[model samples]
Structures are given as structure tokens and as C-alpha cells.
Target: MFKVKVYVTLRESVLDPQGNAVKGSLNSLSYTEVQDVRIGKYMELILEKSDREVEETVKEMCEKLLVNTVIEDYRYEIEEVVAQ
Candidate 1:
């Protein structure tokens, strides 16, 4: 089996309102040391061994549904796992 770890984040050129909100809250709570905050999405997908290339499949999934290509960027790690 393979385990895929996907991380999605807003593009640097895009504004992250949610992250800004969190940062603002933190600052108000006297956490002034923080310079910036960026929120992202983490996802795990378990995929059975298949004929398709893992990297290609993951990239297709990300570009098609897992992430917004225009505004978000994503990367993934694939690990082999023993099924219990």
C-alpha cells in the first residue's frame, strides 16, 4: 500500500484572509513575536498498489480536485506502508 501526504497552501501572490485573521488574533493575545501566519490544508490518501505511477496520479488529483491551481500550490509525499 502507499500513503500519500498532500499539503495545500495559498500561492504567495494570493492574499490569505484566514491566516491574517489568525495572526491578528494572536497578536491581540500579546503574541507579538509572530511576523506572519499562513493557513494550509493537509490531507492523507491511502492508495492501493496499481499500474499507474504514484507521482503522476497524485499530481493529476491535485490539479483536478485536491487543490485550486490558480490560487493554491500543493506538494505531496508518498510512503510505502504495510497493510495491517
Candidate 2:
């Protein structure tokens, strides 16, 4: 078994409206020190062991469905499931 952690976020060159809204609210609430705010998505997946490489499978999933490559970038971590 394995556990996968995926993180997806807008590219630096892209605009993030939600992040901007949060930043604006923080500034309004006297949080001027907050210069920038960016929001992202975190996901987890559990799967049975397979003969195929987990890293390659996960990368394909991210590129095809989990992330929008045009305006977003993604990264992931994989951890082995230890038996209790």
C-alpha cells in the first residue's frame, strides 16, 4: 500500500482571485505585514501496491486530471504504508 500527497497551485505568472481576496481582507483587518497570499489545493490518495512504478502513475494522474498545467504547477510526495 502507499499514500500520495499532492499539492497544486497557480503558477507565479498567473493571477489568483481567491488569494487576492484573502490578502485584501487581511490588509483591511490591520494585517499590513502580509504582503502576499497564495492559495493551493492539497489531496491525498491511497492505493494498493502495483507492479507499475507509483511515481510514474501519480505523475500521469496529476498531469491529466489533478492539475491544469497551463496556469498551475503541481508537486507530490509518496510514502510507504507501514503495517501496524
Candidate 3:
């Protein structure tokens, strides 16, 4: 079995209003050190195959269909799991 962790985030050129709101709230709460917060999405995918080739293929599928590469960046990590 294989596990894939995907993180999708907006590019630096894009403005994140939600992130800015969170940062503002943090500042109001006296957390002055927090600055420039960015919001993103996280996803975990479980793949039934263990082959490295299959894993690469799955990663490509995610990049092409699941994520929008024009305005967002995505990264994924694959891990092998022991059978139960």
C-alpha cells in the first residue's frame, strides 16, 4: 500500500484574503509576531499499489486533474506501508 500527502497553496503573486483575516485576528489577540499568513489545502490519498512507477503516475494524475498549477502549487509525498 502507498500513502500520498498533497498540499496545495496559492502562488505568492496571489492575494489570500482568508489568510489576511486570520493574521488580523491574531494581531488583535496580541500575537504581534505573526505576519503574512497564507491559506492552503491539504489532502491525503491512499493508493492500492506499491510500485514506484504507479506512485509516480498517481502523482502526475493529482497534479494534472486535482490541482490548478496556474495559480496554485502542489507537492506530494509517497510512503510505503506495511501490510496488516
Q: For candidate 1, lDDT tens digit of each residue in 1-84?
A: 899999999999999999999999999999999889999999999988663678888899999999999999998999988889
Clashing pairs in 2: none
lDDT per residue for candidate 3 within 1-84, as digits (tens), equals: 887888899999988999999999999999999978999999887778748576677768877788888888888888888768
What's the lDDT of the predicted structure labeled candidate 3? Answer: 0.85
Ranking by TM-score: 1, 2, 3
**CA shift of 38, model 3, Å:** 0.7
Candidate 2 on 3-84: residue-level lDDT in tens?
9999999999999999999999999999999999999999999867672788889999999999999999999989989756
> Cα lDDT of all candidates, in order?
0.92, 0.92, 0.85
Highest TM-score model number: 1
TM-score of each: 0.94, 0.91, 0.87
